[model samples]
Target chain A: MTLNTWIDLVYLLAAIGFILALKGLSSPKHARNGNLLGAAAAAVAIGFTFAYPEVRAHTLNLVLTLVAMAIGAAIAVPAARMVKMTAMPQMVAIFNGVGGGAAALISIVVFLLEAPGKPAVYRIAEVLFGVLVGSVSFSGSAIAFAKLQELMTGRPITYPAQQAINAVVGVTIVALAVGTLVTGNVPLLVATAVLSLVLGVIFVLPIGGADVPVLISLLNSFTGLAVAASGFTLNNNLLIIAGTLVGASGILLTRMMSKAMGRSLANVLFSAFGSVVTAAGGADGSAESRPVKAGTPEDIGVLLAYARKVVIIPGYGLAVAQAQHTARELADLLMERGVEVFYAIHPVAGRMPGHMNVLLAEANVPYDELKEMDEANPEMSTADVALVIGANDTVNPAAKNTPGSPIYGMPIINADDAENIVFLKRSMRPGFAGIDNELLFDEKTTLLFGDAKDTLAKLVAAVKDA
Target chain B: MSTGILEFLTIFVLAALVGNEVIGRVPSILHTPLMSGSNAIHGIVLVGAILVMGSASGAMQVTLAFLAVLLATLNIVGGFVVTDRMLEMFKPKPVERAPKASDASGDDATGSPK
Candidate 1:
């Protein structure tokens, strides 16, 4: 067989490796190995591309490629390695953004190369699609990263005519894209690119922090589709397969994320839902003055020590205070006292879907001990104490009982079903949804005000004494 | 459309179907890891960047290709390494049978008081 044939076969093998890697990632037992396999597949593909006749002939380009890769690795390794677990969402955002940026650059360069000869109309269409979607994903992910990293406001930013403005921008981009297609004009393409970037930022600006995960998933899918468009431009099968896979999966994942919150994808995207906080806050101004029963750590610790069953519901505050370890310690102490202990995880808990699981896993909490919302809700009524640590919106009765509330119709943990409710919180501030949680003021609820980690430590000591 | 484009389109459609089927089964607990893993996979765009760079002419083309390679490299390298790190914590530790047994006994002792 010729060298070209052999190279194609190798690429095919690498493609199969990527498929298996994705399969392995979905399951708990094989996730790590699956990720490693994917890395190997990527390395093999990149290594073989070096042997392509054209690539090999260009010694200077090859040298530049190697140096660029080395520099990318230098920046990527340390950043990925040293990032705090709480910052994981934004880390993924930045990485995904860079990928989208890369896809746009590839499309633009290819368009420039083919422009001299006036490439086929279909090919130009592909290039334009890549430029549009890729640029949007790039800038959108950047905004997502900023919000999650606290570099900007995590709350949804809304203005009058927001939807109308976005629509105008969208229509202009389409017009510019058509202009590029008809004339094959580089400047028109550039204009399309810039407008698409602007659309991405405006598109993401009104999505609050709680909804950023779903937004990120959608952007991830956008990046995938952008890559697929580039694949069509380059006529690369491996890129086509990999990009299509990600695109399809990302869309499904985005749907799943929205479904988990009991909301539609469009509602999540366009509602500027959390912006109702200000209106809700103004209406419920007296909420802060409402009486809430306060308990000393010692008393609550004794209550926990003697309880037959205890359910822990952890939230973003738990992550923000770096309290997972302390929470685990508290669970262990309670378990030693013969209390049944398990963590009730909300689907949208801790800023992202499944985020609480990652944090708790990092703390060595057994997977079996971490229960999803549906599994934990039925058991809530039987629990003696529902210990809410640094969580608010997920367990809020407002999501269910108050139809007018910002977070209405969303599913929440039935924390009120427990015989007693003990909350560990820093203050009376509302959660990410920016709505009041009436559950906090329920008759059976007891508030223990303090930092999560410090309060968890205090609860552990109090339990030990009991 | 040419037969070549048609074939590529067929492949793309089939791949999308396969992706939806496989990814549909992943439980919510692994959603974060799944997203990150797929993020790494799309880094396959690096191949396109490399191929274009190989035949690039003039300073502008080279400059754009270089940036593409750099960004794609970051996507692949950072994406995979970070995913591995996230999944590393997911590796199940040997369930401490000893603790469970002791926990059972401790339950008995504490159960009488309640």
Candidate 2:
């Protein structure tokens, strides 16, 4: 077979490997295998590409490519191993963003190579689209990483005429894209990329922290589309297949995340939810005006030890405190005392869907005991104790009771229904969305104030004494 | 080239539909890992980066392609490594008394809760 034929076969095999990887990832039993399959596929693809006659002819390029891959591996391996479970979302965002950056760069280089000769308008359009989407994904993901890392405020950064400015920027980018296609202007292309980057920042800036996971998912899809565009510019079949798959899967995941929050994708992006509050009338005034029961670790320990059943609710605060293992220790102690223990996980808990589960799993928590909201709510009212561990908004009754509240209509765990409720909190601070939790003021609720890990340690000690 | 772009569009659309169905059945518990896994796949853009880098004729094009290769490699390496790390955590525990891997190490340093 000719060298091109060999390359084609390798690409075909690599595409199949990616498909198998995706299929395997959907199930826990096969997830590790899926990841390995992807890695092997990548190795094979890179190897075959290196052996291509054109690539082999470029000796300097070959050395640089190999060195780049090595450097990338050197940086990535340690970083991946060292990152805390809580920071996984941020890490994913950064890694995915770099891919988008690479795609944008690829578009620029390809455009420069083709533009001097008056390349076909369709080809120019494809290159422009790649640059546009790739730039947006890169910049948008940076904002997301900043938000997740708390390097910037998690609340939506909104100003006057925010959406209007974004709209104008959007129109300008489209115009520049068309101009580049018509005139084949490199400067216009560069301007389009820079403006698209600005557009990404603008696109994500007004979105509140609560909706960031959806945004991340959406940006991930954008990167996939960008990669696919690059694939078209190169006329590479494997890039088209793999990039499109990722793009599609990302869109689906974004939709699922939106559904889990009981919001539409448009609403999540444009809601400006954190900045606005609604005035609502209710029997329980506001969270600040109402009083709450306060308790110590000793009181909590006694309540938990004597309870017939306890359901634990975890949120981002738990992840922030790095307290998953401590929480699990407390639960194991309760279980040893013959008290039934199960975790009640809110769908939108932590930074993303299934985030709490991943953290808990890392702590060796049994998979069967971690229950979703729907499954856990029915058992909550019957449970003797509801342990709210560094979690607030998900348990708030306002989601169900007050239609005017920001998080109203969002599904939440019915933690308030338990006969007794105890909250481990740092203070009276609201959650990421900055909405005061109505659950804090419930008559049966007892606030145990402290850092999550420290408070959990205290509970474990107190439980032993009890 | 226009015909190539048209053919590319067809592939793009069909692959997207196929992708949607492929991931449609994933349960919520696996979503985080699944997202990370697919995120790694986008690293396939490294192929384009290499192609651009290898074929460029001038210094400017070479520099751009070099940056593309560097960044795409980062995406590929970091994406896959991080994804594998996460997926490793999701492995099903052996039914029989499986030895605690991470938690056991946590225990030796901090000891048990009691």
Candidate 3:
């Protein structure tokens, strides 16, 4: 049939690949294949897009596009191969930001091209909406990525009149958007674009680190919605379909992460973690003197040896070490030594939800022995030894005492309740959100500094010796 | 070479930024519970696809939207179902080995737990 019709068919197939790839990504086993399928579909769509007479005719822009593509591909490959697992959430945020920026850019380009002479109120409104959503997603996501990756403080930075300032910016964006629409002026449109971008950064500036996972999920959804809106503006079937898919999923994920943290979504976004300031626990003097004691693999193994009741309080540290398998082996050895061994897994442990448990299961730890905080909290009181792995915030007692702390209302592991707490840490550095861990200060706690893998291996040997 | 390159870049960059290896390094210690949690996010992808497709106004858009919705739905629902079933299977079965005063195997001192 016609080339146009053939291109449409190709796009439709690409959309299917998006669907399958997303679905396949649900399970780790199929994620690889699903991703490949989605990639192939995307490739076909791109090739077909070039076949369109209008797109092909722009040769200079076309070459630039190819060059840009090459640069992007080159960067992505090595980074994917080299980046650490801890950085995934941040990476996701950054990626979402780029998609949003692209969508916003696309919408603007289309509006300018199609309405070179003039446009109606509705077109202006749609264009403005596109710019606002896209800019917000892009800027907000970049900040979020920064927060998660520790490039910036995870805590909120606010002033007495920050909300008012945010409101002023918000109003400015809307006014500019509406003005650009009614006036049909290019410069005004440009102004609105800048305003929208600034507004996004300001919007997320006051957000604390604890809420980032939710934000990631939410931003992911934003990127999708932005794409869909752009698709609508351009009347593209695939963009609309794919964008909606991403947006809807992101919203759902935000809700789930909110629930996992035992907080509502609104509480996470609008409210500043203003309460963490008044908490009893602080990074203050008492916490400072209580040095974060570090030990070697040899020291921890020695403690595990012949201990009556050894408890493993794994946090994000355990997740990061990818040491669950080794930890499990250590436990098995302890168990063989006539030492009671159990895992105290906190509810909100690791970078994302269920991070610790996922890591442990990879090592094949028995599900039954893994204790929830409510159940495990009490166990820490009497255990001979408490192995505090890469976890920080969840185990912190500050969560309970400091209402001013960002994570004040969140529940934590009472690892401080244990007989002796051994912290398996990499360094004295603070956690993802940069909050000081007060649990490290307890007289009962001792720091064992090393990678989770190395420490667990040492423990395995020590337990064997006993 | 040109158009799809942007989209591909999006996916790979997304993977890298999110600690591509994090999920891959799922420690056995956290498996069942972690799966249960991430499963919920996966479900979101389904909802997203549905909403996108549902709002569309044409045959091709509709078809594409439908494909996304169906797949997302299956991904989430199937994941949760598998997790529940696995949880059930993993539920500490009645132990044939008689209990001793100190079953140091980290066995439930509190008895079979949910």
Candidate 4:
């Protein structure tokens, strides 16, 4: 057999590794090993790419490739290692964006190479597809990163004729893509590329911060499709398989994320869902005017220690205060006093799906102690106290009771079912949804205002004394 | 379409189905990790970048190919490293402490019952 055949076989093996890696990642027991296996597969594939006859013949190109790779690794390793767990969503966005950008560049370069000779019409179509989807994914992920990193406002940015403008741009891009396909005009493709980039930015801009996770997932799928288009242009089976895999899975994930929030993909994308602050729940006046029962940490702690069952609902605010460890300590203390305690995790609790799980796992919280929304909701009625740590919307009764509320019809944790509700919050500020939580003003709910970490620390001490 | 494209299309369709089937079962607890892991997998675009760069002749082609390689490299390295870091937290801890006995252990034992 020739060297080419042998290399193709190795590439096939690497592809299988990627499949197994995805399989392993889905299960908790094998997730870490699964990721390691994928890394190994990637390394093998890259190592073999260097052995290709064409690549080996170009010594200078090979040298340049190695140098560029070294520079990329230099930036990636430390950034990956040093990023705070809370910043993980944006980090993923940035990395995905760069990959999309790379795919777009590859397509553009191939198109440029073939333009001189009038490339095949089919090849031109593939190049245009890659340029459009890849550029969109690249810029869309950038905006997502900016939103998550708080470099810009997380709320949806909308103006008059916003949807109309986006529509016009979309049609223009399609027209340009057709122009490029018919005549193979370089300028037409460039215009398509530029407009696609603009389309990505505007596409993501109107999605509220809370919905960015779904947007990111959709953009991730777009990047995958773009890569697959590039694969078609290059006639590389490995790229086609890998890219299609991500594309399909990412779409499913995007749907799943939206479902978790009780919304459709289109609604999440176009509704600009949280842009308008609704005056529901009599929140028209300043928040300070509303009276809420504020309880001292010591008092709340005594109540928690004596309860037969306790449920802790954590949110983005808890993550912001870096209070996962303290929350775990409080749970441990409660369990010591014979209180049955478990964390109730909403699917979209943190910035990304399962984000809270990562934070709690870092704090050494046992997996069994973390109950999903479905499992925990049924137990809410039996619990004596619902300890809400830095969470708001997920536990808001407004979702069920307020029909006109933006978050209406969404499923929420039944925190109201518990006998007593103890909320640890910094202030009366609303959650990411920017709507008043009527539950906070309920009779059974008592607020403890402070930074989550400080309040949790105080609670731990108070629970111990009790 | 040529037989070559047809064959690729077949593979693409099958792979996408397989991906959807496999990923559908991933519980929500691992969604973030799954997203990032798949993000790393698609970084296979680096292979395409390398091939194009190898054949690049002019300065313009070389410059674009170099940027592609660089960006693709960043995607691969950063994607895998970040995913591994996130999954690392999910790794089952070694028995840090004895399991809590039904009686006097006071639930202070850090070891999970599992």
TM-score of 3: 0.73
Encode model 3's per-residue lDDT on A335-421: one tens digit a residue: 766789899877557766655655555455777778877788777778888887788887777678865666766777777777788
Clashes of each: 0, 0, 43, 0
- DockQ winner among the candidates? 4
DockQ for each numbered candidate: 0.48, 0.56, 0.04, 0.59
Please give the range of 10 consecutive residues that has the lowest summed lDDT in model 4 chain A.
Answer: A273-282
- When sorted by DockQ, best at the front, the candidate numbers are 4, 2, 1, 3
List of chain B TM-scores, one per candidate? 0.81, 0.77, 0.52, 0.80
Over the full model, what C-alpha lDDT does candidate 2 score relative to the true structure?
0.84
Candidates 1 and 3 compared by TM-score, better number: 1
lDDT of 4 by residue, A1-466 (tens): 9887877888889889888888888888998888899899989988998888888678898889888899999999999999988899999999999889999999999999899999889999999989999999999999999999989877677776776798899999988998999999898998999999999999898887788888888888888899999899998888988899889989998888888888899888877633344423334557657799999988998999999999999998899998887887788777767789999999989889999999888777888899999999999999999999999989999889987666776689999999999999999888876677888999999999999999998998898788
What RMSD value applies to candidate 1? 3.9
Candidate 2 clashes: the total is 0
After the best TM-score superposition of candidate 4, give how far the Cα of residue A288 lies from its true spot, in angstroms.
4.5
Q: Rate the local accuracy (lDDT) of all candidates.
A: 0.88, 0.84, 0.61, 0.87
Return the lDDT, model 4, position A97.
Answer: 94
DockQ, candidate no. 4? 0.59
- Write model 1 residue lDDT over A90-199, tens digit each, in one string: 99999999999999999999999999898889999999999999999999999999999889867678777777788899899989998999999999999999998998
Per-residue lDDT of candidate 2, residues B1-114 (tens digit): 557667778988899988888876777777778888888899999989988888887778877888888888888888888888777667477222224544533552363232
